[model samples]
Target: MISHFVNRKRELERLEREWKNVPSFVVVYGRRRIGKTRLLVEFSKNKNTFFHTFFEGTKESHIKALRKELAEFFSDEIFLSLNDYYTIFRYLADKIDAKTLIVLDEFTYALKGDKELASKLQRAWDHHLSKKPVMLVVSGSLIGMMRDEVLSYSSPLYGRRTAGFMLRPLGLFDSLELFENFEYGIRTYMLLGGIPSYLIVASKYRSIKELLKWEFLTPEGFFYDEPYILLSQELRELKLYFSILSAIAVGKTRISEIGNHIGVEARKLYPYLENLIRLGFVKREVPVIGKKNKGVYKLNDPMLLTWFSMIYPHKTEIETGVIDIENLRDELKKVMALRFEEVAKEFLVEINKRERLPFKFERIGRWWRKGEEIDLIALNEKERKALFVEVKWKDLNEREAKRILRDLELKAELVGLNGWEKFYGLVAKKVDDKKELSEEGFSVWDLADFKRFISLRGEV
Candidate 1:
């Protein structure tokens, strides 16, 4: 089991600083299982805090639940008579004479039954909460809904927030802490992404193969039905969203391609695509130096991409126990191979931040031209310098690495960085003669190098 929290030092520091200024209204939100609740709990450890988790139910039921929690906390039956969110919040503001922390977790669920609660909250904060020495934190999982209903310009609570944070998944180095080895950690990351809840669960398994078997192949596993659960919470057009995601998963990136696969017109798919983009599941990508209208849509969540690509289509066979690890072996490799490109991009960004690259690149992303693509590209336009890279998940020997580098040089010319001093790099699962290649003026890296980089940073 993992023994400690990974890298949330920056977030913790910000929370502490915010809490020092009493009457602080903080809004915290992110995707599900991203550790927002855990962060708040950790931040509240030494403070007089009242934490309430909102449930999905009617207003009366939620009010009843809140009343019970308040009665127990203050040891007063008077709270039992308090009805509605406005009264309870007013009571909280009035009763907290000293500095105190109040957390309303899953604020989306709380507002589900009472749409007017936000406006009520606005009035409460204006009349009482703003005057009290209380640090109030509200967190939610439905990012789209939270932004629209609470953080938007027309939102009642828009101007009331003193500070807010849209939490993101942990980075690669922090995610590596959940596994016994870097190889397994990287594989698990490709499948589950950097969501801490999934990482912690995967950490218990002896190997990534076992984790995939139990969590993905089994119908009752936590991740088996997670996409459906998460998507249905924020989206109403489930069938269309699934179709679009499945199309993108299977290599249909362009709007025309996806629309054709889904049997829909491209124009008609705009709303659905926009919603997916807004929800952070699908991203539209254009070549770093290409026309915006000629972009493509791709899955942004590795976990969701894996599910729709592999498990969703074969759910029946998996659920009936007809499909086993052997059946999934090749498909797993394919998924990992695609995901490794993204991992390689991340690696480039990290090394760039550390100034480990030959040049400090101002921009980096995948670059492509008609019928040609570069796996990774880092460019410093003002300096007229560029780095073209090819990422491979297979083991490569000296000759094979050299061949890839030669091909990468050919691709680099098509990247439209004419007159720029160009460089070539290669990343693979394992390289036979990395030192020899580096001596030859190519930036060659392997899995072992990544592990060394991550490990050294962990120590420091």
Candidate 2:
């Protein structure tokens, strides 16, 4: 499938500004397949660049390869005999006279091969490279290793970096370019997510079912072992992490429920849960109404959530060739509904960015009280203004929409905003006579309205 670079305006702008500053050291990191390498390559364009991608190998082998690259770049066989990275770094620092960009992509692999590489690089920076006009860019996929080795307070390179950017998956609006419909885009955002590699593979497929068949359902599919690989890269105890993630994926949101599922106590799971949260795989959230005690945990990565919820649980069935894609398709509708709520929240944020909401809200999130839940609430506590919203993923007729709005008003009262100036909104797949509802003094939106608003703002 044809793929095009969508947008990284903020990152690109930051890198451009760094390029103007001499003797800059920048650290760029993110999870694997999140486009860290692509971003570095994009930033290195039209500049004097020395780009080296460290792969799985021994330190001697990688150093030899790096020596060859340097020898070729400088047209000198002198670099051929260089033994270590320190000497190589000194050579580079001494040779380069002009502004240059040096990108060490996947630098974690080199660190894995040799633990001393970070200190060596730190020495090189202090004694040689820092005196030059070189802009050093180090990028890594292993978040934990990169943080400990390059960014932690105790590391040799600590306090030396001029800037650091942690790249995240693209947002819903940026990901819409991969799909033809708002519905499809929302579904994709909830499933494969906004990771560019996943989106590129998705753009080749016609639908989520097809994408799953090609990349997940089959034993030899690209994503069949993705969770295993991802877990192995950053984690030590694979089985424990897998169990925790599986429990979280299968409707076990509370800490107690997850602990029960994994046969562990709630307090004992904090380390694993905290690590997962740090890795961006799981998220911990508290209710908006009562933030004192009640909280829940959920899988943050859509791809991982889908794998644990579907493919991982049924791995034996899939491997034995008895898996039914149609059955999975039937279940996907329910899964898509939960994801639609997330997309609806993102949609509101996008419109909020355009100042299209009733009043600008500083916070938008799901609020819950006992058994009562509001899908989306945008509020500005300082101004005492709140927008209460209900997100429905199904088509809603005018009567059904009005009933939901009425229920929302009651729910808003339960939110305990006595003096707040409140507004009501309903987001649905299809809201019959949404304009009429909007004219009736409530802010109402449907998929078509959301699509049109996004298109008008040049976001799609």
Q: What is the C-alpha lDDT of each candidate?
A: 0.88, 0.88
Tens digits of per-residue lDDT for model 1, 296-326? 8889999998898889889999879998778
Provide the TM-score for each candidate, comma-separated: 0.97, 0.97
Cand. 1 Cα-lDDT: 0.88
Root-mean-square deviation (CA) per prediction: 1.4, 1.6
Off by over 4 Å in 1: 458-460
In Å, residue 337's CA in model 1 sits off its true spot by 1.3
**Residue-level lDDT tens digits of model 2 in 1-460:** 6467778889999998999997999999999999988888888899999999999999999999999999998898999999999999999999899899999999999999999999999999999999999999999999999999999999999998999989999988788876666666667778878899988877777777787888899988888999999889999989989999999888899989999999989899899999999999999877655674788898889888888878888899899988867858645766677777887888888788788988999988888977999988888989999999998878999999999999999988998989999999998889898788888889888778767876677654
Clashing pairs in 2: none
